[model samples]
Target: MVDAHRTFVIVGGGLAGAKAAETLRAEGFSGRVILLGDERDHPYERPPLSKGYLSGKEDRDSVFVHETAWYAGADIELHLGQPVTSLDREARAVQLGDGTVVHYDKLLLATGAEPRRLHVPGTDLAGVHHLRRLAHADRLRNVLAALGRDNGHLVIAGAGWIGLEVAAAARGYGAEVTVMEPEPTPLHQVVGPELGQIFTDLHSDHGVRFHFGVRLTEIIGQDGLVLAVRTDDGEEHPAHDVLAAIGAAPRTALAETSGLAMAPRADGGGIAVDASLRTSDPHIFAAGDVANVDHPLLGARLRVEHWANALNSGPAAARAMLGQEVSYDRVPYFFSDQYDLGLEYSGWAPPGSYDQVVIRGDAGKREFIAFWLKDRRVLAGMNVNVWDVTETVQGLIRSGRQIDPDALADPSVPLETLS
Candidate 1:
């Protein structure tokens, strides 16, 4: 039973914060639960912001984690548009932007990350945007629709998941698209060259131009609106709009101010936490993108900014908050929907960590399951357009057993049999 006198406060209004509040209630905690968020809107999922929402296929209300009534029903004090400015661990209180102070018996920092801004010249122009929130996606949708009607060009400054997804969406809206990447191949660092080439081919077949091994130096604008992007190769890509999808940095100001231990800069620079998601102070916990957890599977600390991490880590942090000794050991999982490709990846292995990649299906057709192996043991697996095999793939990695490469590559061989 929870101590009703104790107050549980969650800082953040994202998916992880909402999930943590829900978990506390589900675990029979009747304590005072408060969720504070900086945004005016309620907690919401962000994946569709670049794909379905930007293309106008999904409605705004669909992104929310819960209906507004649910918060009151669960006795959760929903504090929206109130940014927490400082965390006073000694006082056990959090100060809001409006000077409101709330004391908590236990605190969960689910503060998610923010997009890394592009500092190139003219990036502050009107036609340039970054997709991290609903408002950004809505504005981009309008720009895409206008470009679609006028046959305008949309220049994207990164070829990562967000950039590629936005490119696909812009193309669907009839906007001519160009994607620029600093690397030789997009997603090469994550999925390797061979698989990354497949995506390049996919985008190329759809008429999206790519400038590989080039850096975006400036955003050229006319009348304070983005007109083009100039790259290091001295090539100019015409643009009606520009999107910087480079990456994100953790929102760690609150944690830092609270004097919490932080991870190393190379390890994604987040609040350092143990396997139980507890920070230095036993009463305070951290989760989601802001948390650099000592991952059991990786045998090192990792801070994952994907949707799956937020979804799984929230409840685990809540369990730890409720005096339960629980470890957030779920393997990292992420998926992307770009044009015809529905990709699902499970587990984690840094680039160059795996020795061999064995495929079970046709790569040319984009219908395949590829396994990344180290010492003949599965380290990670990705299913491209393959159905209902995620659990099986994750099972293989969890089992940590060596298997014949021939069996891994054979389509008729059941993955369950490999164990």
Candidate 2:
């Protein structure tokens, strides 16, 4: 009972696009569904690329979002390795790279972000790498294994999540790793200096050398292979490979060219969308890392690049596209696994957004729950080596209730009671 007249087209072949297509069917939308992707591989999740896959604990097959036959069985017309070259907003169509133009009644852009490249010299060397895509991870995996076996060195630029994760993986493989960052501490922007020190200590304990308050200026290579990297401080570190783990920028070129409203760069630029995930054009919607949402509860526009955002936002956008009332007010959530430590973070509390950081349990032992509060209200929380309190932590944020700092910092006080 599929409707042939109305067509729903999804661009990008990541988790967001794949989940949206699945949700459309689950919601009983029997229209023609077309999904376009630039990569030849089927839709897949990204968390494993940095964690299990890179660490040699998971196989490649575990990354795919669904079996190859699932798309065909779902009646989802998937065009892989064909990128959308241009968007025709007026015609309500998009032209593929191979020159095929497909019209849509409703369009969803789940196009994700790309890793920001290091513009330093010798970046074109053979051993320099970036890890935003599966291809990159595949190559880096081999490189890390080789470097580990040979006792080679890896110099990483920017001690962000990607860098630290890779550093941990390399250490597990017995490779010498050094991280260079312009910030004074690791994850300075996300967790702030107060919590960043925890990561600094963690990585340090694992033999990962960190160069803080310094920028990577150049990569010295010999015959197209990385040899070492030089920093602004005039120190050179021997390196068999260099990884640029700086950050990622949203893919907004197509949206901008189609004349869609864009968020300001200051607000983390992307396609501007309201709470319903609707863009300026009613027929078009956006989700995932490419969409900057004007969040209702946060009262701020946010563009989250984490796996959880993609997992939730895609289905939310699918419902919105089906003419269902939708409010995507889910607090941003993400988790990281490093060595023997695992942590889950919920809600948003970028530095300057909170006034105090209250910790329960022992930070020195790396088993604690840290709450970032502003005006006695929990803005965000992170649980390290702590189990199954994500629900209670998110509840505190959603409740927006003023909390007693002493109670929040006491392990004896249950978070459920506070909310």
Candidate 3:
């Protein structure tokens, strides 16, 4: 058992940061653990922010991973709303926003990520929001609350995870919503065009209008608040608010400024992390949306911004920091509930590796699953309106076996024996 000689300092109090701190105690690290967060709220589940929290089905307390008693009993120092301004690697210390310095033996960076900013005209105007932090969610929730009744409007830019979940929640509250994406199909980048089309149809069935193949040029405002959005197609949309969810870029400026051997990307993208989730410096580790960990099956590095990745992988990094020789070899899994549809997805396919995909069940019936395959091996799979088959398909992907479409598509074939 550790006897308080070593101090484990974790930066950023998001899902990853919280999980990492918990994993240390669970893994038998009894030394001092300090968790610092920029936001005052405890590390809560963010996926719900775009859904239940925004929909008013849940409140702020629902956001926390555990109650207040859990942290106090665990002997963890909880520092809320305290952000690290700089890292002095040479001194093994971190400088806080209020000029307080924190010394540490090992530093785990779960710094998470920030949404890409939209600097177009009227961006500074109120009602133009980016759904990233909990404070932003609270603001949107206030908007919905002030309406006094159901039905408002949400004009969302980018069809990524956050935008869809927000739209789904708003629609649940009887809000008229529209989503605009630059791609013909929003999920095309992840699941390919075929399955993405299925999502388009799913949203359309629920009266959610989609403006495809378009980009937001400007957000028009009235009285310093968003009134509408103008698109590249020379069309203007009158909207109550605008949400920009294009994507997130890693906040690696502090690490980079410290001369921590950061990698360069042509487009200024995600932070690079090895299999152990260690940055260029072995002493400094990273996890969550900010770090680009390698996908074992894909044989390529990827940044999975899903809650599952953060929850599981963060602890794995913490374990490594505690002298445990472990590697992060988990598949990417994420889910979203839109209208009556419960969509689950996993295991991104290798680039251009699949010639065709075999889908099982019907789409409109909302009870179907599709498999992305290459060389008969299940690269990735998604289940829509089907929960029973989740365990079956997930087992197939876990086994990494050869599968026959005829057998899988039949629904009679037990997914367990597909090997």
Candidate 4:
């Protein structure tokens, strides 16, 4: 059992860090719990940044993880807008941005990620934005609302979830949007080409143009504001604004500088940890996007950048920190809302890992469950516009039993039968 007197410090005040602090207190740890976040706002949800919040359907306070009173009542010291500068492993101290050193008996690094910035020329121009922080979302939301019911051109670089969702929201605001992707299809790496085409069709049907197999070469500006985007194909697409949604990189500089062992470069470069989320230093643990854990299900070290992982991993880390035996073997899961489609995906199978995809419902109808299988065993499953089946889908992946392809692709055969 962990001594109640030990001070526990948690860095990064995003959902993961907040969840860790909540877990520590809820698990009967009477120790001092301190959460340090660089942002001015308290721990908040990021998923809404692209959906309800960005579209003006939700307000600012709805995004927060908790109200101000919860932290004080929990006896958790909340340090907002204090960026941690360095970690001294031997000294058991963390240096803040203001050069103030704080000591702790145990530390948890839940530092999330930042949107990968575009490197092309003219990226600094006005009206070119990337949605990551609340402030950024607020600005974009204002822009979209100002152009309400009027057609404006929005040039989006990279057709990932953020780009696509923003495109949908812009369309709702009467903006003519165009998305460019280097891949042949959007999100082909995560979901296979077949499933990716469904999204492409959905966007195309709504008049969102696509420039596949193309890269943004430059952002053209007039009077220090974005006017157009130039692609490598020598075509310049005029735009009133631009959004670069390539992807995100984990904030691992603190761990890297502190000499924490990193995962193999192929696993996307995060602090390496075992199934229990324990870092090389037993006193320290890493969770959320900053942690590249060895997953027993995938049988490989994988780094997941999803809200579900962020919410679940911290509690597992807290339990393990308290000397309770724990293994975070939960199947990876994530969801996306694009236009009218609501998608929930469970289990993780990297590209080329799954042999085939079995569809149990019609893709054209936009309501169905698709299963990715390898060696006749389910690897992952996705439900689109379908309700209350995620647990059953996860159960199918965990069962590890050979399943009939015909039955897997038939709606008449219940999922529980396969399990």
Considering every candidate listed, which one attains the maximal TM-score?
2
Q: Write the per-residue lDDT of candidate 1 for residues 1-419, one digit (tens) a residue.
A: 34569899999999999999999999989889999999998999999898788888999988999999999999999999999999999999999999999999999999999999988899889998899987888899999999999999998888898999999899899999999998888887778875788889989988899999998899998889888889988988788888889988999999997789999988879999999999999889999999999988778889998999999899899999999989777888999988889999998877888999998899999999988999999989999999898899988988889999999999999988996
Error of 2 at 7 (Å): 0.7
lDDT of each: 0.91, 0.95, 0.81, 0.90
Better of 2 and 4 by lDDT: 2
Model 1 Cα shift for residue 142 (angstroms): 1.3
Model 3, position 202, has a per-residue lDDT of 73
Better of 3 and 4 by lDDT: 4
Whose lDDT is greatest here? 2
* TM-scores of all predicted structures: 0.98, 0.99, 0.94, 0.98
- Report the error of model 2 at residue 14, Å: 0.3
lDDT of 4 by residue, 185-227 (tens): 9887888787999989999999899999999999988799878
Estimate, for each residue in 1-419, the C-alpha lDDT of model 3 and write its tens digit. 34578899999899998999999999888899999998988888888788778888887889888787888788889999888999999888999999999998888888887889887888888888888888899888777554325456779898877778777777766677899999988676777787778778877888789999999999998899777899999999978878888987787777777777554564234667778888777778888877777556557777777899889988998998987887787878888877777888877764386877888888658688888987888878888888866666667777877777788787787666785
- Give candidate 3's total backbone clashes: 0
Residue ranges of candidate 3 with Cα displaced over 4 Å = 1-4, 145-151, 263-268, 350-353
Q: Point out where model 2 deviates above 4 Å.
A: none
Residue-level lDDT tens digits of model 2 in 136-191: 99999999999999999999998888999999999999999999999999999999
